[model samples]
Structures are given as C-alpha cells and as structure tokens.
Target chain A: MSTRSPTPVFLDTLRHVETPEGIELSLRVAGPVARVLAWSMDSLIRYGALWVLLMVLAMLGEGGMGLWLIALFLTEWFYPALFEVYAGGATPGKKALGLKVIHANGTPVDWPGALIRNLLRAVDFLPLLYGFGLVAMLCNRNFQRLGDLAAGTMVIYRDPAAAMPQLPPGRALPPPFPLNTAEQQLLIDFAERSTTLNPERQAELADLLARQTGLYGVAGVERLCAHARWLAGEPT
Target chain B: MPLETIAAELRRRNAWEATDLGMVMVRQWLGSIYAAWFTVALPLFMLLHLVCWGHWWLAPWLMWWLKPLLDRPPLYILSYALFGDPPDRRQFWRALPGLLLRRQAFAALTWRRLDVARSFTLPVTQLEGLAGKVRRQRLRDLSYPSRGAAIWLTVVGLHLEIALDFALIALVWMLTPDFIALEFFDLLDDSSQWGQLWLNVVGFCGLSLVEPFYVAAGFTLYLNRRAWLEAWDLELGFRKMAARLAPAGRVAAGLAMLALGLGLLMIPLENFAAEAPSRSNPPPPAIEESLMNPLCEQRRVREVELAQAGSSIKQALAETLKEPELHVCQVQERWRWRDDNSTESPPRSPPDPRPGQWFAATIELLLWLAVGLFIAVAGWWLWRRTPRAFTRARQRAAQSGPRLVQGRNEITIPPDAGLGDTAWRLWTEGQPREALRLLYQGSLAGLAAQHGLPVRSSATEDDCLRLAVAQLANPELLGFLRRLTRAWQAIAYAHRIPDEADARSLCLEWPRHFAAAGALPA
Candidate 1:
C-alpha cells in the first residue's frame, strides 16, 4: 500500500480556485515587476493627461495663470472626486495605473473609501514628497501607502496572453512497433537533443535516433516506431 | 458530441473580454463632463467674487451668464454617449451596480488604492495593524486594481477637454468681429473682406474643436456599447437578487444605503440651491483674479523671483526627505533580553514605555543609539513585539517549499517510486509541471484510460495497454511503451496491476522522454 502526499492535491485545488468565496476574481499570481510597471504606466498617463490639459489652458490665458490655478485645484480634489463618482478612480491616472477603489469584500469602492484615500494623500505625501509613501510601500506586503491603508484598496496587474515552445529534431532509435507519419515525425523531432545531451553530440545522436525512430531507417526503427504508436494513445 | 460543442466549451473556458478601450472611453467622457462643468463654474465663481467685492456692475457686462451654458454642449454629448439615444436617468442609476461589479474595472480600482497608500508616514505598528485588517479579507473590496486605471482615464479625458476648452476660448476671442476688427479690421477697411477672413478663421477653428469632440464622443459610445454587450447588467442583477434573498440584515443595510444616497442627492439641491440668494451675497474670494494678477505691481519681479526660490527650496526638502534613510531601518540587535550570549537570539519584547511620553523620547533614543546596552535591550524587545516582523515570518513560513536548483535546463526525477506516485511526488516537488508537459505530449495508460473508461477498481496494466492500443483513436503512447508491451500483456491478462517499484520507475522516466511521444510532421 502507498500513501499519497496531499501537496499535489492542494496545488490542484488552488489552480481550480479561480474565485474564492464571495469574491468575484480568479486567483492568479503575477510577477511583481509586471504589476508595478502596469501601475506606474497607468498613473503617468492619467496625471500626464491632466498636466497636459493644464499646460494648454495656461498657454491660452494671461501667462497661463488660469490653467495653473485649475491644475492646482485639480491635483488636490478634482482628480479623485471625478474618478470616484463616475469611473471610480482618482482620475484617469489612477485608473490607468490598473488600480481601482473597492469595498473590503471585493465590491465596488464606496464614497467613503474614495474620500479617505484621496484625503490621506496628504499624509502619504509625508516629510518631503511621496517619500513616506515609498517607505510605506517598501515596508508593507501589498505596497500600500497611508491613503491606501485608510481607504482599504489595493493595486494589482491584469493577465497577459500565452504561447508554447516548439520541439526540436531527434536521433535514430530502433522502432518498437508500427508508426504513422505524424507519430514518426513527432518522435524524430522531439528526441533529437535531450537536455542531457551535449550540444556537439546532439546532431550525431539525433541523426542516429531519427534513423531508428522511422524517420529514415531499416526494420523501420522498430523501437522508435513502437513508442510513437503507443504515445499516440494520449491526447495531443 | 459534435466538434462545435467541444470548440464552444474550449472557447468559453479560455475567453475573457477585452475591456481596455471601453474603460478608457468611459473615463474620458466622465472627465470631459466634469472639466466642462468646472469651467462653467469658474466665471460664475468670478462673478460672485466681484459681487461681494462690490464690483456688481461688471458682472452683467462681462457675460458671466454665458459661462454656465458654455459647458452644455459637451455635457450633452457626453451624456448621450454614455447613456445612448433617449438616455434614461433611471436606467443609468440601475446600471451603476453593474458598472461597479465589473471585474476589469474593479481590478483597476484596487491598483489605485495601493498607489494611494504609499504616501503616509504611518508608524510601522499602525501600518501593520491596518494590513492585518486588510489581509483578513475585511478590506478586499475596497482595494481594487482598476480604480487606478479608471481614475487615470478620467484624468486624461479632463486634460483633453481642458485643451479643447482653451482652444475654444482662444478661437472665440480670435473670431469675434470686434476683436478681429480691433486687431486687423483697421488694416483692411472693406467690410466684405473682413467678413470673409473672419468666416475662414472661424471655420478652421470650428473644425479643430469639432474633431476632438466627435472623437471623444465616439470613443465613449464605443466603450459604453462594449460594456453593455458584456452582460454586466445581468451579472449585477443576479448579485442584487442574491443580496435580496440573503439574510434580513443585509437586506436592511442595502435599503438603508439606497435611502442615504437619495437623501444625499436631495440635501445639496434643497439646502444650497433653494437658498441661492443668501449664499450669493457672501461669495468666496476672487481666487482666479488674484492668482492671475501680480500683487503690488511695483515689486512684482522681485516677488516672483523670491517665490520661485522658495518653491525650489520646498522641492529640494521634499525630495531629500523621500530618501530611504528616513524610513527603512535594518533590524540587527542582540541583547541580554533573550537568553544572553545565545548564538541565535530569541525574539525581543517591546519596552513598556510610559503612556504618551514614549513617542518623542523613544524616537530620539532609537535614532541616537549605536549598540549601546539600553538601546540593544529595547530594540530586541521591540523586534519581538513588532507585528511587521511576525507577519513577515509567517508569510515566509507559508511559502516554504523544496529548494530546487536554480538556472538548470534539466530537471532531475527522484528515483525509486511507482509511476503514479512519482508523478504526484514530482508535482509536489515542483516537477509536476514537467510531468504535465510529458502528459501533454502523450501518455499510454492515460489516453487508454480516457477512452476505455475502465472500472476505477480493476485497472490492470494489461487492461490499460489493450485500451491504449485498441480503443484510442491515437495510440502514440501505447506504441512508445510497446517495448514493455509483452510484459504488460501478462499483467493485464493475469488481472494484476504492477506494484509500486515498476510504476514508480516508469513515472520517473516518463517526463524525461515524454516530449518525443506526440510529434507530428507539419
């Protein structure tokens, strides 16, 4: 009798757990650098948009005073308020940052959370600039600033697309059984250079296996043929 | 089942609607409407300021009334784009829930919250306390990633609109017959020539303004349509239904929130707008006017220089304080507090400082201390009690796993195990992924097992092998294992599954050779 370790079972369970109870998201872990870059880009775009607008407006008025005045007001209140109420972000900056305002249980961000986070932007600002905020992020696990702590919100990255690797050619091996063209090709191609094989040795071995595996062989690489035919039993 | 059924299922399993463009558009329109509204309010505010300053005569002549209406066209366009033809306020309100629950949108919100949280000088203790609350799932909803994205989108929209508005005003000034006449009409006194020139300039400016607006409106409409098609409304309706059917307390809370929202909406209209006259009398200061003007004109240049210098100093100070030395501190204190002279010191216990007095005193003492006895003892104590440290340790422990050799091209399979056991073990040891790769290529018993639907209890090696060869549409794996077919034939016919060692060896060797099992010529 053999006892099974529950580790695989747990991991399998975790994989299938797209969403936890009461939450609406599939639980997928992402790389930290990717998450940070996505967020930074989002913020830059949003704040940059506002800044550009202000610059244009300023260019229009007497020495751009009107634009500057509006920009100042916007940096403080307008950015967050408009996003929170309509798009549920501080501004396009926050939104682009791949961040959202939500309730504690993964619901839409309420007005209080929005207000608290925006208001605490002053505290997160700290001794000089967002230095305090940076420190907070460094110290905290989720990289939350003071405003985020107050607001109870977080920043996370979204999913990207997927791709697969192609197989290499193989060496000649004796065929063990009958084989189809596709199966023969698959075996010949894949077993060409096992990771264990040295680069210099790979081509020589692959040619040998290919001949035996039915790619170019006599007795038609019986072992290779047999393996290819048996392997066909599994899904592609 | 037909291939269509399989394809449909696969598509559904893999599908996720792209929401980026839609989110971007909605945020842009929201920003536009808000910015336009703000613009309209500016002149009104200015007029109100002048009225309080007893410059009431200037208000009417300055065309303050037109300020509010200036934003109308943009607002109308935005409203139409967001809500569609024959826009309904009720439907808009109803759709709010759906919009709120959107997955991508919600992800953006969480990102926004994390960005916001980084700004404060929150003591490590307090921050940890908050983090505890957050990680406990108490604060999950409040921290969505998409909040940041949506906000930034709005910011962009606002900027675009502001630029448009500025261009509008500049165009307006440039096109006015009076201004044109003042600047150029004198140069060419012919009325028809002046009119024609003015018409051409106006036409050009009109085209510029109309293009951005149309683009913006179209973008917003596209996003709204996409959002609608995603069935966000249905999702929200289901959630609402679930909440309604839940316990009475949740139902009551939901109702209360609705009532509160309704009341809040009414408060501003009822209180402020109704008493407009009283409010109008005591207007806010002339912020824009003063901001635009140089106070005490004689010293304007000197003042500007001084202000610029001051701002630079402020910026420098802000930047300096943001440096890491101010916040990040390493923990390396060993004191007699936890088993004196012990190589691995036990966790420290925090000092019981006198209430309300420790803040300034401890900060200074801690900053000044350098391996001093008192500080060491205190630091060790503090480290022990620090929730941050505890949380870090806990997390580290949770993530502990078998150490795999890093940067290796080849994975080593464990020896001495049955095939199934080996696969399971490899998976636990971070090699299951490699095994899965093998499985993807082709596995003899696995394919046969899938096809034959063998009895769970009676899966002899022979039975598995026969199924692999006879039942499977494809038998690459069985062919690969044909070297052992003679041996397996006896086991299957004899009604006996291979014992632990044979199975284990097969499992171990399988992944190393699995890739070659399913290759096909292009």
Candidate 2:
C-alpha cells in the first residue's frame, strides 16, 4: 500500500518487491537511455560478429552461404535469450553496462520468460526501430516495454554493494542526546560526504546542530563526526 | 537555492538515474512544459516555414538548428517548478526574453548547438549565470562524471526523434485502406510540396515529444551533479535536524529553570528537617506495642484485599472466556444416506396402474438417461481440453463457499434479463445504490468474461479501471467505462447520488456498450 501512494513523498525509480520468504528486494529499474545504449552496443557486437562470419563464409562457396544464413538466424533470435538465461540475465552488452533482466517480482529471468520476451521483440519493433517499445517503456512505471510487460520481466541496473565509508579521524563520542535511527544515518552520511563539501559549507551544516552539541564551527563539525563514528560502532 | 523547498527527492544517484529523474520532472509538469513549448515553438516553426517558403527544406533545417533556443522555455519552467514555484503564464512570459537572451545564447545557438551534452550543460550557463571561460570551467567540473550519460541522452533523443517520425509514417501506412493502394514508397517520396510538408510536420511532432525529455533530463542531471558536489541532501538533512531540535532546546531551557526552582524549595525543607530535634527522640515500649498491633491489623486487611482481587480476576477470566471470538463454532452440512427403516414414510405417492402412465414413465426415464449421457460427454471433453479446469473450479469453490455460509450475499443478476432494463427498474424503484451497484458489477463481469481481462474479484474499482486501460483498445468504450467508474465511485464512496438525468443516461448507454457481450453468468 505504501508503494501505491498517489502522491509519493520521494520520486525514485527504486521498486520494492517482497519475496515469498518475506524479504524485500529493492530494484532500480533502468530507463530508456541506458537500455537504448545497451541495445546499441549489442547491435554493434552482433553486426561485427556477422561481418567477420561473412568474410570467412565468402571463402567456402555455396554451402558456407547456407551455413551463414543459419548462423544469422540463430544470432538474430536466440542470442539475447541464451545470454539472459545462462549468462546471469545479461547479454554481453548488458553485462558491460552493469544491467540484467529479472522478473517483475525481483527473481532472476528464467528460460520461459527470456524466450517469451525475446520472441515478442518483433511486436515491440513494429512501426520502426522499437518505437512502440520505447513508448511503452516511457509510459510504464517500471520502464517495462511491451515484451517485458508480457513476459513479466524488467531490466534493472545491477548495482554493486557499496562498501562502508571510512569515518573521519576523531575520538568516538556518544551523541549528546538519544538520536533516532534516521538521525544517526544522517550523521553517518554527512561524515561520509564531508570530503566533497567545502570547509565553510561543512561548518554551516554543523552549526545547525550547535544547540544540541553545545559547539560551533570546526569543533561542532568534529563533534558530529565523532557521533557518526560512534554510531558506526567505533569503540570509545 | 533552499534545498528544503526542492520538490525532488535529492540523494546521491548514478548519472543515468539522475537523467531518469529529469524524465519524472517532465512527466510531473508535462502540461506546463508543453503549454510553454507549443506557445513558443509552434509560432516559431510556422514563422521559419513562412520565411523559408521558397526553399521547402530550409524551414525544417532551420527549426532543427534552433533546438537549443526552443529548449530554454521548458527548462526555465522546470527550474522554477522544481523549487515548488511554477511560474504563472504572465510570469513565464515576462521571463521569456531574459531566458532566451542569456549571455551564452550566442554560443549555445551557434558553435555549441551541436554539443552532445547541451541539455546537461545548459543549466550551468543559464541558471548559474556563467558564460565564456567561466561557463567552460564550470561545465568541465560538472561533466567530470556525468558527461557520458549526457552524451548518451542526446544520442538516444536523436534516434528517438527519428524513430517516432518513421513510426508515425508507418502508423499512417498501416491504417490506410488496402483498396486505396497507398504505397509505403509514396509516403517516403518527399519530392512534392505536400510530401515534404508532411515529413516536416511528422519531424516536428517527434521533436516536440522528445525535446522536453532531453532538456529536462539534462537539467536534472546538472542538478544531481550539483547536489553531489555541494552535498545538498546533507545540508537539507542538517536543516531538518536543527528544526527538530529547536523546540526541544526551548523545552530543555524551561525544564532547567523549573529544576532550579524545585532545588531552592527543597533547601528550606532540608533545613526544617534538620531543626526538628523530636525526630531523633525514642518512644516508650507501650507506644511500640500499639504500633505493632496496628501493623498486624493492617497486614490482615491487606490479605483480605488480595483475596478479593484474586476472586474478582477469576470472575473476569470466566466472563472473558464467554466471548464469541475465543470459542468459535460452525454448522457444517454434509450429505448422509437416509436409513431404510425410518419411521416417516418416503414423501411419494404410490405409482398409478394405468398403461399410459407406464409409457410416460418410460419416456421420462429415457430423457433423464440422455441428459446424464450428455453431461458425461461434456465433462469428459472439458477434462480433455483443460486438465487444470478441475483445480480452478475447486479453488473458486473454496473461495466462494465460506461467503455463502457466512450470509455475505451478493447481488445476482439473472442471465436471461436485460441488464439495462433491470437497472432502470431498480432506479425507478428508488434503490439508486443497488441500481448503480448492479451496473458496476455487470460492467466488470462483462469485461472479464468477454475481453478476458484479469479482473480478479479482489481488485478494487481503481484496479479495474487500470486493467481496463491496459486491455481495452476502443477509446470510446474506455471513455464510457471511465465515466461509469467515476459515477460508481461517487455513489459508493462519497454517497453522492447521481442526478436523475445522469442516472437515466447511464442506464440507456449501458446496453449500447455491453449488450453485445451478453449478461454475466449469475
């Protein structure tokens, strides 16, 4: 129900799907731009490979031409499906772009889903150059094309797990007051991103909590950093 | 500049996601964006065509070249809209000249017109008010990480524009009647004035559709880059923390004063206690004995109170146990064989001994046997056709069986009766809610049965509407269904009775849309 709010508080493409095991998986659905780029990359690879095959086939006369046609058919049709099912839901291009196909419910793409989606690419390609697919993806909440929708699949960016940021050097100190979970996370985020923020702006931000910390300027910034370190489970 | 008032949720995001955020911005303010877009671009498009009337190709070429200029207004609107202060028409019109004539306008229109990341870099020049060397330096800074995505955004936008143009042509070709013999090659032949004009129009439509998304994507990408560089999300977080703690600080100050006052009051009490010498005086044994007697009596009284509390708790537990939720019972029905030697006679009369009766009985038995054979054949065919039919039937039975037992009755329209006539009759009978309910249920059932829409019984009205939009291709039918849904929602949720005219019109229109599909299976 929280997912279906008419006016959401925050606008992000992160879709949350709860599995049968009650674990929630957050998927950031890829948009049209990235998808188009990935498709283009795949197209280039397919064509390049075909061109090389054509040169080799030209040497072998008529039988090679027939063999080349069969190879082209296989490459055109089963190329994406094979990679999606066996290569962890990503074609070579998608793998290069760090994207993968998955079910709408966040499961990995299986053979049936892969085949259905790839087969329906013909419909999505109607009009010209996947125009219908582009329109469908743009209109969809999850950026699902017609093929993706029919096959109950979606393309998502395969985000690598982020390592914990090293806290700024400071003695670990407890927060002056009992900070809630969100506030503690904020403190940690501030500490992590402080390197990008200039000293003046950092001081300006720290000065906001001057009343709570009973410090201001650089000392206040350090106090917050210490709290962040403490919240990150640093001893003492 | 105040991050707190920023409409979009700000956080560290990859460049592509940032571009998607721009798409979100365009979607949210699409009306305003296009209103401003067409207001400026349509006239400009016409004017350019008029000026280049003799050279048919020149107009489209000029229009394509001037995309950077056309992109400014929408970006101007989006920038204000993002900070929660979308400009009114007059305000927007007033700002138009300044927005279009920014210091970088010349560079943007001429040398920078072909920039792959024009949208991404536009904000740096326009909103940030930087130009020339400063603008380049700023762009360099912003483009450090996001340049690749911005370039791709432009590339995709270019391809999308061409795709949409061809798609429109393809759509026209597909829709043309076969008897007309409109060749696809003829559609591509832009040698004639009409063909060229049509091509230009299609191209313009595609540009209009895609340009806003391009500009908005670029703008948000810029904003996202700025957010990362400046730690805007963290700044907002800090502001929120300050706002939250401000009141608490005042309360703490007030509490400190109260404590000070309480400490001063306690000082006098402590002094008074120290001055009391009778506090340390020893009493006699008779006084001690009196105290001991009272203590024993108090213990006996306490024991009685505890015993009374225990009995009252036991009574409450007994009372609580009588609640229906704690002790559920159900009456179940099952078929059982009747005893052959029952006291009550079978509820049947003795068979007639006439010869005509024997012939009638034979015909009836033959009819029953035929019916059973037909049922058996039909059942066998159904089983052969779909093995899962039995499982589905069992699931449906499991779902609906309990509601019948619980007496949760639903309205059932007879399959033979006309839906519109029945609904109208109900309305005239002053059961407006029932009439509307019948219409809503009938529409859903018709859609599910005829269209094979996956409209589950558990789906809400809104869900049904969404499913209808996805499944139904007939716009007129979709429109009718939308209106019907609105009317039904009004009655069901808001309890707002439809006007007599509206109710009558709905009933009359009902048969026009749904009659061909037949009534739902009761």
lDDT tens string, model 1, B1-522? 111111000111100111222222323344444444444444454555456454433333333223213323333434344332322445444543333343233332344333322111011112122444443352243223323433343343334333433344444455668634454333223255444344333333333333233333333332333223332222233233334433465455566565465444334433333333332232224222322433312122222333345578544533443355532222335555554555565666886667548788887787677558777899999998999997776555333211111112222332212334556565557553444433222343233222333322234445545655665554544654653444344343554544545545556555443433233111
Candidate 1 chain A: worst-modelled 10 consecutive residues by lDDT:
A8-17
CAPRI docking class of candidate 1: incorrect
Worst 10 residues of 1 chain B by lDDT: B7-16
Candidate 2 deviation (Cα RMSD): 31.0
After TM-score superposition, the amount by which residue A58's alpha carbon in candidate 1 deviates from its true location, in angstroms, is 3.9
Q: Can you tell me which runs of candidate 1 are displaced by over 4 Å?
A: A1-55, A59-64, A75-104, A107-111, A161-236, B1-522
Chain B TM-score, all predictions listed: 0.18, 0.50
lDDT of each: 0.40, 0.80
lDDT: which candidate is best? 2
TM-score, candidate number 1? 0.21
Q: Candidate 1, DockQ to 2 decimals? A: 0.01
Candidate closest to the true structure, highest TM-score = 2
| RMSD from true fold, candidate 1 | 47.4
Model 2: lDDT of residue B432: 90
